[model samples]
Target chain A: MENSLITADAVEISEFPHLAQKYSVRGVPKTVINEEYVIEGSGPESMLLSTILEAVEKTGSG
Target chain B: MSFIKDADRPAVKERLRDMRSDVTLSYFTQDVECDFCRETRELLEELSSIEEKIRIEVYDFKTDQEQVRSYRIDKIPATVVSNGGASGIRFYGIPAGYEFSSLLDAILMVSRNESGLSDETRKALQDIKVPVHLQVFTTPT
Candidate 1:
């Protein structure tokens, strides 16, 4: 599944206040992809996959 | 003082029984200023005790320079789940409440050595040549 290419971290904002501030994590389940694209809430698997692909495309092109 | 309640042990054990391979939980923590470090470590220990295939490796965030660098850990109370290989699954805080499911899911996925993604998603992922890091910020609430 090419698992090695994708890294996922579930961060608890309250524990790391600094990270929450840096990422502007004011809500729960805020997903930040590659420090670029930000997903504000949880969604279906398809949505996450698309976000990942979008981030990858942006990184690849830029 | 156990983070995992005794009543929940059997269910947790049953879930972990599906593991096909050994999964290592590499936890990094410092002695000071880390609020959930102790609880996180205890939770991992209790979880590992439930299944023989799951192992917990503790490292100091400030002292374990090599591990910190290799894992690319920049924060305290981080747990990296792997099956003796880089799986790129990590938790950056105490995986409590609903988020605990995510930790278990990662462990099971690593043990199975599969992402459980759909064929189409897997195909799409093939085009990803660069590393994609996903930071899902959540609260225990």
Candidate 2:
């Protein structure tokens, strides 16, 4: 819902190195919070919010 | 997607003229295999031409082992967003569809060194002193 109207080119991720193996970046849009919390595949609104909160909680800062 | 066009170039150039801050769009692509590499490179170059403070740098994904290691990237078709002098934020897929806001947000955030997040949100993010990496992945839905 946040991104609509605009083309896909603006938000595309096109640069990554192979060492991400350590990060285990398995899927696209995989958000690792402060290298501490790992939010898996993108989920629906409710699930996404929960994941964001979980990351924040785990970080114990933001 | 082709900001390199004749008509649109002037507009972007005009806007970027007065803009303050140095931004770099680091484009990492492979030579022969990837599908979107060409298009992404084109877009970065075009965008760079539009903005004075913005510059685009392209690197080989497999061959540039040094850059790959330094940038901490593990995928192609990604972008490492740099603001002022700091370079680290990355996107692993096309930043479009619903993620455009995030892209523009990154630009403005880098330009201003502020996220442009709401007051409450700003308060929330300001406490970040340690390395804070936030990744959000999604399809163009």
Tens-place lDDT per residue, model 1, B1-141, is 987899999988887778999999999998784888899998999998888899999999999999999889988799999887888888998998887888888888889977898888888887679889999898887
Best by TM-score: 1
Any idea how many clashes model 2 has? Answer: 22
Docking class of 2: incorrect
DockQ of 1: 0.78
How far residue A27's Cα lies from its native spot in candidate 2, in Å, is 15
* Fnat across every predicted model, in order: 0.89, 0.24
TM-score each candidate.
Answer: 0.94, 0.62
Best by DockQ: 1
- Lowest lDDT block of 10, candidate 1 chain B: B30-39
Error of 2 at B62 (Å): 1.7
lDDT for B88 in candidate 2 is: 50
Chain A alone, model 1, TM-score?
0.88
